[model samples]
Target: MADYYLAPDGSDSNAGSSSAPFASLQTLLSALEAGDTGYVRGGTYDESGFADGSDQHGTASAPIRLEAVDGADVVFDFGSGDTGGLRLWKCSHWEVRGFTVRNAPSYGVYVFGDSTDVTVENVTVEYSGGDPGTSGAGFHVRVSANTVLRDCVSRYNYDPSSGGGNADGFAVSQATDTVVEDCVAYGNSDDGFDLWESTGQRLSGCVAHSNGWDLDGNPAGDGNGFKLGGGDVPSGGHLVTRCVAYQNRRRGIHYNTAEVAMEVYNCTAWDNPTNFYFTAGEHVLRNNISSQGTVNIQDPVDDAWNSWTLDVGDPDFASTDPSSSKFLHLTTGSAAVDAGTDVGLDFDGDAPDLGAFETDGGQDVTSNVNPVLKAATPTGDGDLAFTAGTLHYYDGSRWVAPPVSYYDGSQYLTVSEGVQTDAGLVDGFERGDLTPYAGDLGSFNVSTDRAAEGSNALKTAGGRSAWADIRSTEKAIPHGSTFQARVYFTDAADSAILRFGVADQDNWLGAGYNSNESGIQLSESVDGSWTELGTAQMTPVTGEWMTFRVEWGVDDPDQIRIRCFDADGVELGTGTTTTSANQGNTGYGFEYTFQYGGTGPVYFDDLRIV
Candidate 1:
């Protein structure tokens, strides 16, 4: 039960104290016993003289810890020839934290051979596999039980031999009671998180994105974002909750041919080529969202409240890119908000959100009710008895506290208010019909390729000429009405325009976009004389989605307010202007026009009027 120090400048024969620190990590680790703590000073520990934890052992109550001192930067540079940076072979009750290990030939940290109670936290492992002949992983744990890996990042590990056949960020094999939480893995040549032959493993609040690609952006790997199990193994009873997988080259979350009982709850999969592909597993999926992908799930599974079966819109994640550190926060108006089942989890709204990150502004009703309440003891009739967190009402015969499960399958006491429904929804395109609207020179059809809500969207293909628009049939528009719609562009059109408002051939007061210049234009036509009131830059990316909102007759009959939002629902630009008064309009709808010879297509969904 002592504390030792390791520094780069000291000698191995030193006293191993703070002042006279041991020079090498091997020396300090060799001397550590149960209840011993080694403080690594701020310096790079080259792999040439690194410590191995094969013979070191510790007890559960007095675990050995190797931690960076005072949040100092400790680097374990394994160079390119070493097989691994930190190899803990058959070690028990060891904790490693706050270290960056990189450039190992095989793995950054390897825990092998029946290791137990190993905790790795706040560590980063990168660039672990440079050898073509050997497979590598950032953090590889095999035959380890009761291991916890949290607050860690693994990225940029590859195996060049088999085109990254066996490279992963974090891999757990033959392990039991393993928990991986709050970890992120990206840019790996193979799967981000791989679990094989593991039982009773839980992964929560983890994110995996953009994996299965080499450093040169080549797709030379099998890029499943989170590969729970595979290889004809009996990996069973794994739970994955609140995890996010996005932009991986292959399926976002794949339970591939693992004949086991797996459960996934409140996970989000987005932008991957094929999201949520489960082949031969007995899976229980609840409240998960797969936004963009070909979702293929086999039989023998219980899927409930998943976004794929509901009329769900885009998840509207706060930031799709991990660089923003706001990867999966639901936007204010996201359909995923409050769309999950209440399964004894902490949630902000009436229920949990369908994704990893819940929006912040939702109300938490759990705290409003008193967990500890006093009730009158049942004496004769119509009295309530409170005991063990439950209140029972005596009906003169038996004490009953109502049915525990509500008709809708929610806990009676834990159920908050009803799920919030969107108001002023004019057309969500959920009807999957184009008869309500009319197309002029363009072709209008309902497409399932992409949508902001539901499974269908209004797809418009422009004709050979410009201004080939699609307009609504005959919807009345009142003064001071606000209109909004989500638009998705399949490709770049130099001169595409999407408009919504009271419109006809001559008298039109609406808002539109000038795609050639990437600007939003608010215009009104008075007796066929079109006047452009204002313009603002809102260059949307090609093949991306954006929201457009307009308020007509605000403050005055001629005043207009225009706003635009990116996919994340962040206001990109806004403008307000006053044009000539023209308030006598009866027809309202949307109009989209594309020029570039009608080569590209645009989708519109979630049209609302308020």
Candidate 2:
């Protein structure tokens, strides 16, 4: 029995049997005979408007079937451009179930190349592509290797790349033995399941939440769920079970470091703020639970506080956002209850839990230990005297800085007890007056310790500007090594430029500079007549204050060169340095502009790189 009739009032030849129904779904599956089964009599099979070499080329021992006419309800949409859905080109043993494929400007269902046994079950891919680039891809599996996507459901297939670039619910690139199990990709904005550089895959019992989309419509970049391995290192080994990634601003599972061998069982990532990061390669995580806001087990390239078996609090379930009508909102005993880990399978025996349900259990404690996680007990006898009460300063970002409207709005944001002031310069800003009182924004030194550039320095009249920018470390001048800078200018402005240098200034060693682009060989010009262009790149140094960037003025005549290259005219390397008016030809002034290139212990920072 063969019956095929698709709306818009029928009749292309009418002979697909059941009632002479034969209006070309490749001529009613080429008049089926091999494993005979053909029936497509729905109402809306527009494929947007059908014409662009209309094709539904299916073949594998004569296979072509699209059944659902006995109560009528099936659809393969094509409302715009990339050509009317159902273009499953390149031969394969196929089975495409109960249709509802909408808007395709790029790809609704496109599986190209020497295609294999492709099965797209109970399909429903909407909106395709919208915001960015063209509107394409709902079920787009390219360069196909071994495909399978079961019980699929992708809503609002947005491609916020307009010309049709960023749109993915199903975009598994460079595929291998692929398997996407029990699927349900919600509100897909950017990444719902954007698995790139593919390999043997298994994404089981899936639920990619929020799936953010609408940056152009502006929801601020919504829930980006499941973006595992970005830019290299995902060629094989797979398993990401029982998933439910909530809110998802950054992660639900984005670990692709080429470390390869992987496994993440019984998963549950709540609130999902920048979660899960690990690499020693061969990965395996049992009974997973990363709670509300930030779960980074390790990744800045290395040292993850000693890798895994982690529990950073609150996985107390019953309320980790779960409810599709199968037991949740559990407050009963709560702290994630019976906890989990069975590898044996228990419908609800209570103890194999860690995410996708399993009796809702929680708590493995993960062996405790977060006692500040060790490493920071070296006060070495303490006591550093600047003489009056107590005021010291040097907080690194690198080499003298203060230009973000100068801090009243607070640009750099980190302070764990660093930055105090006394010894001289006291006016409005710049490293000499010191501010911030911190740790961890970028650099830090006092030769190596007093916490904030010890030895003696405090200058804040606010001209060459350095609410703090410390950098140096080019040996200083070997006289046992230790430089110094202390000024308390009132500043009426006749050029207050104090700059210092050595390495990381374009990677400098000096023939006049290149330690990665230099702080301009050191400059020091204090005026309004407190008169003291200090050492101006002088000589003896191990001064080590360390904290840099915001060298005021902008270039040369007065100093301001942090990390170099801002390019308004271009030319950050070539001489013209000396000037207390050229004291001793290069002695310059103010303790040799904090000295470097002679001894060794000078890592200074707090403005002066023009």
Candidate 3:
């Protein structure tokens, strides 16, 4: 029943108190007793020679609790190479949160050897693994059960020496009753999320994208977005619901090569070359959408209500831009709206909408049109009136009138604005600060040295070792939206490579330089995976600027259009991209990223989103 503190400035000799905290995690773990809570202050911790969790053990009732202080950014940097940042071997009942582990020679966090009831939440693991022809992963759990990994992100982990054979964002093997929810895995050289030789594991509300490519933009791994089962043994009876997989080099949601019984529901797979690839298995797939690729399912039993079978045309989603919160909204005219079979799942319309989300039909509400009232007896509060032509409902206290006009048999009438205005300005960098932008992990500022139109422009710079991005705070692009921007860069050699696009809920869409830096690359980030659309050659002059524009649609993968221009507005290139069927909502913000390592400064100005 004691509390301990670990800070970078404190020492082991002092009592582990708030003011006199232990300087090292090793020292604090040695003093931790069952039911003891350890608070780690904001700082960079270097655990080089320490054996992770070797001396730390807690009971089932009173697990060892290690957490970062509120609003603290705790980072564990394992310089160059190390076995692991935090290792839990043969340990049980431990809880860890709010800590980032990076640059480990092997795994960022490894839980192995019969560990159970271990919870890892709000933890980020990246930049781990350097063993050539060996294995490494951002987070690896093996022979463990009853593990919960929630709200965690794993990215940019690779083993280049092995040519990207064994490195994944998050991997679990031989584990049962494991639940991974609200998790994201992207940008790893290997698979984004993988489960091998595991059964009774459930993955919900998770995303796996842009795997199989190293940070340097080179393909060197297995590259599946979500690999369900592997190994010689059959790993069966897994459940995956409300998950998304896109832009991976291989199959999006793969059953691997093993025969397994699995169930997939309400999952979305888009832009994956092989979207849904399954081996010989007894699988149940319902209410799922695969926008592209050859869906290979062997002996599937409850397969129904998929986007591939519907001949009603495109599902007309709201927005594919991941930057917006509602990227996957179903539009009013979407073929998927109310088209799914009832599987005892609650829905908004007459029936369930196929895919991960159900569109509420609220976005289609127009001004002045009266909704038709249904004739039904009121059984609960706020129930709609069922009487024909009735626009009022009886409340417990009183009758409530509807806000809009009731539907007249002749024509639907509503108010309309006399005129429409031009699209609003998203950003121009005139504020002289990046206060309107948020950084995922990188450095950015307003620069006066270069501008495409004004005296100031947004400048971003980051190391080539990782991904860095700055995104606009406002979501300005809606369904059927168009936007453009002016970008400036010195040259291809500057290593200040940049990618401009829109991101939402772990997915992205945009174009940038290829990892090889030889040509321009058009890509879409589905979930967290990057899918290459097409490539073109357009060399940039040193110290010159270019203009780029895009038009997006709510339905059809072929409706995404992008165009590039020189400083003089000369058309350089134009192309169309494969559209994602399950695009969620509106476009939130304009994003700029220094993808991979190419140090230097990149500038942007005159951004507009409509």
Candidate 4:
């Protein structure tokens, strides 16, 4: 095992030592035998058309490695080069890491001719194959086997002469056993990850966005986020899990004429022309989610518990803003949360979430199994239990199926000191009285205009002073509990802030629809100063009722999660934040405050602790 060095300043005739390094990479690469390591020093190397070590071979126990120096910015600039920038032809057991390759007329890094056991990590490839009518890619692996690519990025590699059709971020053709993990491909001319006639490919935690477009914003290539297959051979057997594809020009995850079965689990596709275009393969899809795009799937595909197959609506994403980091993550109370069948994947809740990112915040799942449907009746006592998704009890003679209890707008609302009703412990403003509230009662009233459930709702006066709020009477809300309510804004043009949350004399923790920002906000106040925790973009439309759910201590004793739903029960946005406000303290109840001035009133109804 020996060490060699390459630098931009040294001469090629110099000894490949640390003091007198070789000038070009070819000198170091061609001289490295088995168990040799080459260090590329920081600086730009303008070498082109060098292929002396293209067919080098290394042993399994003593593989060769070429890596950038620690904390060095090593760059290979193939300026107007008419060949592949870095070619590893028929190389075996080679590892390359921490380097940048750009401005090549062909592929930035090409590993072909049966290269096996090659690993590439932390490498960035951009601006490859920009010449006229030339097809190129950032990373191309053809006829390669056992290749691993991790933490790599490929972007802005376009072939305009081919109408952006031939340039891809990462193209693996006729390859077997390829693992691409934690890679990002964006702003490319063609598909992000193109696998043609490839088998046994596993892509996990990869993100592909803004692909299939040229630098001039012209539509180019197929525009697929992940084109899993394309060739005459029906090669498949691919596994794509926890991957995100968004904002592509065409399809997000496509099965391009591949006949073999592929497994796509817990992937998310959003903002594409077509989310999942699985028309050819007999794919196995589970715990996947697609939003804001058309789903075009054919028969023979084994799919279940997906967002498209379920009768329920969208998965209630935490944030739809693609620019935000949490684009497709699930939120609290989402239909996608814990709604998936176990598919041999680890999850964070009762079951797997139907998306790329789990929302239970790392909660351990003890057991996740679909309920069995018992066709035979109970023969003895205590044999009756949950059978076929319903509770059946033996009444000493026969099995009696009881009504499944669901949320019917009644639970956990109680007051230990004040009046109570069958409706709830907190006032629903149904009695046309204000007995359950103690502060600022004159600024609110029961109106008959609109309500979420019943006919009447509480309406706040139009002109209340800034910071004036009404507090409900003390109710028994335990720490780490969650509350839900429905709120309607009568005037969209108003700039007033309709704030609703829980509060005590010293601490205030809540969320509200702030019209001034045209968004929803989660905030906390200790003493008298208020601090915003998180905010999401939302447009307040007139007469649009929204549901807000605030959960205290969801992940920890000081953590809070907030979710806001639109009129159609679709989640608009969500936020999470930690609070220094007191938990499990007395005199804590719901509080609705009018902050700032507006001309129209806001309505609140259907308050429940759920």
Question: Who wins the lDDT comparison?
Answer: 4
What local lDDT does model 1 show for residue 385? 69
Q: lDDT for every model? A: 0.72, 0.44, 0.69, 0.72
- Which prediction has the highest TM-score against the true structure? 3
Per residue, candidate 3 scores C-alpha lDDT tens digits across 435-546 of: 3344553466777888876578877655344546655433345546577777776545432222333444356566544435455666667667766777666555446787
Clashes of each: 1, 107, 28, 1
lDDT of 1 by residue, 445-467 (tens): 77788888868887775454555
Q: RMSD of candidate 1 to the true fold?
A: 18.8
After TM-score superposition, the amount by which residue 228's alpha carbon in candidate 3 deviates from its true location, in angstroms, is 0.6
- TM-score-best of 1 and 2: 1
Give the root-mean-square deviation of each candidate in angstroms: 18.8, 25.5, 13.1, 21.4
lDDT of 4 by residue, 13-60 (tens): 988999999998778889887889999998778877633357777789
lDDT by residue (137-188, candidate 2, tens digit) is 5776766766788767665566545422356677676767778876666555
Model 3 earns a TM-score of 0.64
Model 4: residues with Cα > 4 Å off, grouped in runs: 50-52, 131-134, 361-610
The number of clashing residue pairs in model 1 is 1
Q: Residue 9 error for model 4, in Å?
A: 1.5
